[model samples]
Target: MSSLPPASFQTPRQIFAAFDRGDLSRESFREAMNEHALQLIEEMEEVHQNPVAAWMEHLRSRRAAGKLGREYGEAMVRELLVALSEVPEFPLARWIWNADRPHLPLYCFLRPKAEPVFRIQKIVCAPFVVMVRVEYGSSEKSATVREKFTFTRDQVGRLRMSGRERVK
Candidate 1:
């Protein structure tokens, strides 16, 4: 008897053999993959719905904290939540080509015990228009730092396409 679940029914060998030496359409492959994922999620939800299984999960969590220490267990949960909550906001495919190129100035702050030098780079738009203030540091040697606010879309676009010259 096979211990493999129904979700593993479509093995990697089968899928690859099915597409042997042939070009597969992007839309068709995407649809098939999406359906497979949905089915797996449904099966997992079913497994987690049992009362005995739920109690086992609670016991496991308590045991983990006892073994690892309370701080370590709490840190693990916090990190997991942070990872789960993070969504890639940028469009990766479109931005990949320009990722290496410098667009905006990145901001940096150095402690007095360290180099005593500070830099503010790649400052861009803020979320709110009226309520928030945007500021950047000047030269590290300077006594007074200059603050800059307000940026235009044209400025950002120009930075994004910095290397190439415009054709007349």
Candidate 2:
């Protein structure tokens, strides 16, 4: 039996396919669609305070604990810049900063000096950027690899992961 909670929601494709098939439960579909947005916004309030500063502090902490890999902080900040692209250039970022909203959740993996129980993986499609940093191996040996997945959010006013490209 796998320890990872069975993925709780349907994939974007699955939901819409079921919708087309006329077998979709509206409530289940809503909940399923909400899952990604919800996960992404888990700590959004905190990030909104000052996205740059908050990220800096987070990176600092990760570095202090020897969890962050080379340039991962810079990588995260760069990816963040892309994620908040338009909003930050205008006043929207400030608005979001002051708004009552949850903080964005980063799909980050922090490792101690130990072997990983399982590998982590996720797909994010963009103008939105999904940043991932992974450390694998054991206390005696390990390796860290970073990747950025870019996606363009569909503009039909629907929430979905539409396009994906492995940027590195």
Candidate 3:
């Protein structure tokens, strides 16, 4: 089992680390976060039903080619959703996706008091269709040598890793 939320019940959080400290109401924040998540769920359901968009189509093609498996894509979606949950501002998530994905799965670890920085080096990006980059490693330890993984948006419209990541 993974520390993942069921589709209907997402784990609530402070959700606004990027916001300047302010006097926003907790209830308001929760309401806004929930609403944002609901909208994403609605979008995901739509894509899951009709995966015609480029990303979704790409995922389907990779799975059919056996370069990416269904579970792999699902895992990426789950992990991306979990990471996105930590971000409250909707636009911020999109920004992170565009600018920080090269360092993603890395972004999943973003948390307050988490000042430690790590470097990820990408080695390859062409092997798996789900791969956003070819290879990457942190400063502490490199990933499995030549063992590759990826993150992609599933038909459900959730961002998921391409392969299994060990979770305790």
Candidate 4:
């Protein structure tokens, strides 16, 4: 039998790195990431329904062990609640899990050694694309950093975050 959280949790980060290296095509990257995201959301829903399940216990242990970051448990609860109420702008857990690089600005849900507040520097809305410049946060190895998030409207006009890159 396979483990509850599946060792494939790190697959997205590897896929993203492959895309960065031009080893994977953009379409393939999007497809793989979206599939992985759907799987994670399904698991989150399952855990939400059965809070005391074994999978939940495994996740709790991971959080306590700092395998998933300090604020992961709280963030997961918040994400589940928001998901129950409405669709989120982006997959918060996915981003947080993949943000392992020292240079990358820490996700809002994470509490680094020194917590840095985020500010929305700019937002440009267009017909099909929306660009947001966010001052994300500082990490232990880096100073304050800004990131550009690109969201594109789908067929039904729901905006989905497609890309995140460090702002120069």
lDDT of 2 by residue, 42-74 (tens): 546646866885566556445532422233443
**lDDT, candidate 2, residue 43?**
44
Clashes of 2: 12
Error of 2 at 51 (Å): 2.6
lDDT, candidate 4, 1-168, per-residue tens:
012233344356567878999998999898888888797687567668766764545544344335333433333323222221122233233434433344543233333222332334455556787666655344333565667777776788656677778887
Range of the 10 consecutive residues with the lowest summed lDDT in candidate 3: 111-120
Query: Model 3: per-residue lDDT, tens digit, 8-98?
Result: 4323333463123554467766776777578557646755765565355444434432322233443443344354433333222321233
Instruction: Give stretches of model 4 more than 4 Å off.
Output: 1-10, 54-168
Per-residue lDDT tens digits for candidate 1, residues 1-168, read 001123323332234444564544656555655655675476457547765754554454445434433433333322222221121221111112222223411111111111211222222222221111111122233432333223222333321211211111
**What is the C-alpha local distance difference test score of each model?**
0.29, 0.37, 0.37, 0.49
Q: For candidate 1, what is the total of clashing residue pairs?
A: 6
Error of 3 at 73 (Å): 21
| TM-score of candidate 2 on Cα atoms, chains taken together | 0.28
lDDT of 1 at 163: 20
Spell out the clash pairs found in candidate 1: 104-122, 105-121, 105-122, 106-121, 106-122, 107-121
Order of candidates by lDDT, top first? 4, 2, 3, 1
Find the number of clashing residue pairs for candidate 4: 0
Give the distance in Å from residue 152's predicted Cα in candidate 3 to where it truly belongs.
29
Candidate with top lDDT is 4
Query: Which runs of model 2 end up more than 4 angstroms from their true locations?
Result: 1-6, 53-168
